[model samples]
Target chain A: MKIRHRDSDSGKIQLEMTPMIDIVFQLLVFFIMTFKVVAVEGDFNIKMPRMSAGGAPSDQLIPPLRVRLTTPQDPNAPVCGIYFGQRQLASFEDLRNEVAATVGGGGPNADADEYEVELDCDFDLPYRFVIDAITAVSGYRDPSSGQIVPLVRKIKFAPPRQASGG
Target chain B: MRYKKADNELLEADLTPMIDMTFQLIAFFMLIINFTEAEQDQRIQLPKSELARPPEQPFEVALTIQLMKDSKTDQELIIYGGEVMPLANLQRVLAREREYLTRTKRSPADATIIIRADGRAKTGVVQQIIETCQEVGFEQFALRAQQEEAG
Candidate 1:
């Protein structure tokens, strides 16, 4: 079958690569802009605490106060306690008292509609203690103002460790 | 006159289509840009963990603990994020913050505390930071970590 028809006259079968090239350039630009240079920070040695359900605190909008749990270097004593700013929480009663007093001190301005408690606990601390402390702080009421308020509403847990295995 | 002109002999590709594609790519990049300039050190490679999840909402308020290496040694400690003060001071800070929130009638839990530390940091150092937050009655905390993005 020898049938040739003058090579179809003009022979113009171009793929209009201009549009494709434009798209490729566009994609390149998109990737360059969207490319997030993520810089990983923190100790690469320590294994973070595995959270089951509530996992790591994911909400940044919720304000949390930092608390550190420490036992004095004395190995013989079980004097593990809480440190808020720089003071130790000697007893649960003290926490209770503080919460109650603070609420009371709010005075005429005290209102339940505007109060909350933030809890930040250490990873190694017994879970029960944290709960107990939470309860005490949460169930506080101002005696003088007669205003009941939950000390904490949103909780953000701190990282388990700062450095590697201590 | 016979070879005078061939109609449509300009042979130029229409540029509108190409411009449209370029615009699309630019839009995509703009969407993924993270504008928050967090001055974090790059040398510190964060430990990779499955636990790393970006926060749901930007933390509007936070109690920050800036951990610094002992200029003299490798030791790390809570430096600029509230240390060497009476627990009362913490209570005061919380109370003050609470009091302010109360006046505005905002939920007291509307804030977060970010505990930032060096990667070569120690557990004990971090734990101490947590204790401080607890004493002032903070119940929540967030430990930061990172992982390599897989191809």
Candidate 2:
């Protein structure tokens, strides 16, 4: 009996492109469908333990500066007035200036823990206004250098007011 | 005069460059594609601030709590794990989350609760959520905000 070998030298074997092309198209479609255009997001971190569990650190040089955000009687009102220690600030800009002045030209490596701001926000005041107040006190964008000047990073919310439903 | 083309020659379109380009595009998309489940709800408009830069280090464990305030009805809704609940009923949901964390061998104290709240949301409600988290043994929090566009 003679052993015969199969033909190993078959002419140029055509590459199968259909399945690969199909898979590639499928991936492309999947990626295009899931592509979401989102604005870059950031976080302002807070470390608040329960009041009963070791209240607050006492290494502060000064007492917490009280920044109050008040609103009109209307439930849907934005922040109407921002008072920094009894003195009413005209706007968030003024609040930022007031904070910068009080903190003595806060720099990049300023002692943030020593200076604290307690946000005493009104029950009806919008949360954005509180964020504005926080941004104003926490830091500011320096125009000349286009850098953030660190002011007070220690921010705490005053006790929650009466729940106004929303 | 009539010219006849050769019938034996097969006309073949070159697909190498097209496949190469397609593969390049796929590679590019894969490189830039974000797979992380970022909870960016459309209903809540984030507050923008110049100081709000992305954190340098990603939190090892994070739980996102979304809050939406209806402008017309003035109703507050707490959204967590794809379920919407009222603010008054959110403490129960938070307690469950703490349980889940512990079951998975993760300490609730190390987890950062990321709050993506509507700008119009009531501050009191937000504080209540934080307080609830505090009671549940989570101390860390991150107030999410949009990066301010330069004026």
The C-alpha stretches of model 1 lying farther than 4 A from their native spots are A1-35, A39-166, B1-13, B39-44, B54-103, B106-110, B147-151
Give the winner by DockQ: 2
- Which residues of candidate 2, in runs, are more than 4 Å off? A1-11, A52-61, A72-79, A108-110, A163-166, B1-8, B103-107
Question: For model 1, what is the alpha-carbon lDDT of residue A5?
Answer: 72
Query: Best candidate, lDDT-wise?
Result: 2
Best by TM-score: 2
Alpha-carbon deviation at A113 in model 2, angstroms: 1.7
- How accurate locally is residue B15 in candidate 1, as Cα lDDT from 0 to 100? 73
Residue A16 in candidate 2, Cα distance off native in Å: 1.4
lDDT, model 2 = 0.82
Q: Going through the candidates in order, what is the number of backbone clashes in each?
A: 51, 0
